[model samples]
Target: MGELDTFTDALDYPVYVVTTAAGERMAGCLVGFASQCSMDPPRFMVWLSKANRTYRVARDASHLAVHTLRDDQRDTAELFGGRTGDEIDKFEHIGWRWPTAAGAATAPVLDDVSAWFLGRVEGRVDGGDHVGFLLSPVAESPAGPVRPPLLLLSDVVDLSPGHPA
Candidate 1:
């Protein structure tokens, strides 16, 4: 492992599925690099690989939805993480709906997730091989029953990415 891996390898971060739609096209991908960057303005950032289809569509999209998966949702993670949107319509197999919330309509909100937030893409930063999307939360799912264990990086470590990063 490399020097950075030495530290990151010891930490397990939650994985998220980010979805975006540009015109008639829609895309979603499993993302490992994301975090809340601010509190006062309620900002979050999600980094997308430049080579991924989601990034391509997101370039024109005004909003995106971030979904938190449960520990038992390995199959959902595999579908989004292991397959390319270039070849398949990943949303067809998954349950999702266009947000009824006014500004959050640009992306599909995934069903049955532990939690999710629809954010407007306020800015994009070119971050080497990936681009960081600064998001301002516009809508979010209401709190449900007791939360379950979240899907984490360690849980999906064996998954081969659908697209080269």
Candidate 2:
């Protein structure tokens, strides 16, 4: 409706599925707003919608797993972006695991992805309607010889948000 909105609407970035765990509770959401913010310490930031279920669970989570959706993972995108976790148990339907490191169990990690990383939450930044979770990548999944193209926001723009943002 405004110039700022128009500028943002023209932007397209890779989509990500961010998952977090708090005790036995787990939550994940499709995220379009994220980027590598720093190079020195290798920091990645993910903005979680305040209204999304994942934001609530991630509030107290120590770590999070970021899954980069592949070009063919539209179904996976739909499941996370279109369904509300407040009404359903998405994990029960998705194939995920708590990627272990030094036998230290962590959050739910999506099984199939172009790439995923486990990160320790270093800080949080409030961004009006959303919150940015600053991450320090601890472990990354094995990279494939042929890296698949990442799924972009335009690929899932038709999807309505599971929770109002």
lDDT of 1 by residue, 1-165 (tens): 666988887899999999999999999999999999999999999999999999999999999899999999999999999999999999999999988874446899999789999999999999999999999999899898788899999999999999997
Poorest 10 consecutive residues by lDDT, candidate 2: 98-107
* Candidate no. 1 TM-score: 0.97
Tens digits of lDDT, candidate 2, 1-165: 765997899899899999999887899999988999999999999999999999999998998899998999999999999998999998888788878761476678888888999989999999989999999998889879997888999999999889998
lDDT of 1 at 103: 47
lDDT of each: 0.94, 0.90
If candidate 2 were superposed on the true structure by all CA atoms, what would the RMSD be? Answer: 1.1
Q: Give candidate 2 misplaced runs (Cα > 4 Å).
A: none
TM-score of 2: 0.96
Cα RMSD, model 1: 1.1
147: Cα error in model 2, Å: 1.3
* lDDT over C-alpha atoms for residue 85 of model 2: 94
